[model samples]
Structures are given as C-alpha cells and as structure tokens.
Target: MNLFEDLRNKIGKSVAETGQASKRMIELSKLNYKRKEKKREADRIAEEIGWIAFLQWEKEQDIRVNKDLKSGLERLQYIQNEIKLLDVDIEKVKSDKLLYSDNFYPTSNSPSSEPSALLIYLCPYCAHQVGEEDRQCGNCQKRYY
Candidate 1:
C-alpha cells in the first residue's frame, strides 16, 4: 500500500508540472505572434513613409509637407510602442527560460557566388518578387500605389 501511494504522488506531480509548462508555452507563443504582427505593421508604415518621401522628391515638392508621410510616422510610433509592450509580456512569460537568441546555429543557405546583374523588387506586403512594371503584387494582390 505504501509503495502504491508513493508512485501515485510522483505521477501527480509530473502531470501538474507538464500542464504548467504547456500553459506557459501557449502564452509565450501568443505573445510572440502579437509581437510579429506589430513589427510587420511597423515595417509597412516605414516603407510607406519612404515611398511618400521619394514621390515628393521626384515631384520637386517638400517631403515635410506631405500629409501621408506625417500620418505614417505617427502610426509607426504607435506600432513600435505596441511591440515594446509585447516584448515585456514575452519576457515575463519566458522567465528562467533560455532566449531564442541564446542558441545560435549558422544557416546553410548562404550564397557562394557573386550577385546577379538583374535586381529583384519584393512586394512590401508579402515579400514576393515582382517586376518593375507590376502594378499589384501577385501574391498579396495589394496595389503598389
């Protein structure tokens, strides 16, 4: 009877520890997902600002006076703040655990040859390669304009 009681206690502790670890993993994943989303939005807004400034320069207009550029800057700031908050949450969830950056492994996909003469343009939304004449991204279908 004593042996059976000790075995049951050990099993119960293992189950509880596994459940807690699973819950923490789920929380961490959710936080990381939200951080990625915020970062993507920030990237899009920064790209928009760059494009607006370029267009203004091409038209010989003042980029500072561009309303779209100003708006994109404000949105980018907001997204950056959100990313900071998500980072805090992720750190809290990952307390006492090794960070993703702690384990580093070199990737095997490095290019060995020189760059090609042809330049490839990637869509800002989906990162799909598009021709210079493409008005919309084929992957995301988002208009370039």
Candidate 2:
C-alpha cells in the first residue's frame, strides 16, 4: 500500500468537510443570547411601568394609566417583538444547516473566505463591517462602543 498516498487522501477528505453544521449551531447560540437580553430588557420595562403607575396613584388617586406607563408598556411590547424575530432567525439558521451534507466537496467559497468570527465587529447604527481592532466604522464613520 502507498502509505503517503493514503495519508494524503485521509487528510484531504478531513479538510473538505469543515463542518458548517457546527458553525450554524454556533450562530444559533449567539441568536439565543440576544433573545435572552431582549427578554431581560422587557422585564426591566415592566418594572418601570409598575413604578410609574404607583407614583401616579400616590400623588392624586388617578386610576387612569399615565403616558409614562403607556410608553413603558409600548417599549416592553417592542422588546417582545424583537425576541420573536430572533427566534425566527434562529430557526432559519438551523434550517440552513440542515441542507449541509457530510460528503461535501471543496469549493472556491471555502471556510478560508470567512474572517475570524471573533476578530470582527458589526456596527450598531449601520452595517459597517470592520476588524476587531478597528475603533471606527468606515462606511458609517461611527465610533465603535
């Protein structure tokens, strides 16, 4: 048996399947974390709603909810909507992973095309893609927090 040829074949096969399935799973995890943060924000808004209502009651005995409480409730609703959208995004990521097969071949669009996932920052205002070391976004010219 040609030992060198066998070794090369095995290594080539391993290199071909870089496991996008795992990458998608990792992305799903990040989406879940974002969803959890939104939920926490909603909880905080709920607390603010209650406190504002109590203050209005203590002042003049008005049973009608004030604009402050209504605004807080609207904010809570917006946060919940965000959480739902995240859930949809998580599902889409998972479904895309399902399309992956173990016997995949290498294409020009390989894993090397992807930058280091940890070495990039997305702009909060506009999608100004930049490296981790970048302090400002090139497209939007916004300072990264």
How far residue 7's Cα lies from its native spot in candidate 1, in Å, is: 1.1
lDDT of each: 0.71, 0.70
lDDT of 2 by residue, 78-127 (tens): 99899989999988887666644434333345544322122235667776
Give the clashing residue pairs of candidate 1, or none. Answer: none
List ranges where model 1 is wrong by over 4 Å: 96-145
- lDDT of prediction 2: 0.70
Q: Which portions of model 2 miss their true places by more than 4 Å?
A: 1-13, 58-62, 99-145
Best by TM-score: 1
| Tens digits of per-residue lDDT for model 1, 1-145 | 5435545755664565456567778888999999998898899889988998998888885656557877888999989999999998898878634422232211224632321122457778877777898989988899985
The collision pairs in model 2 are none
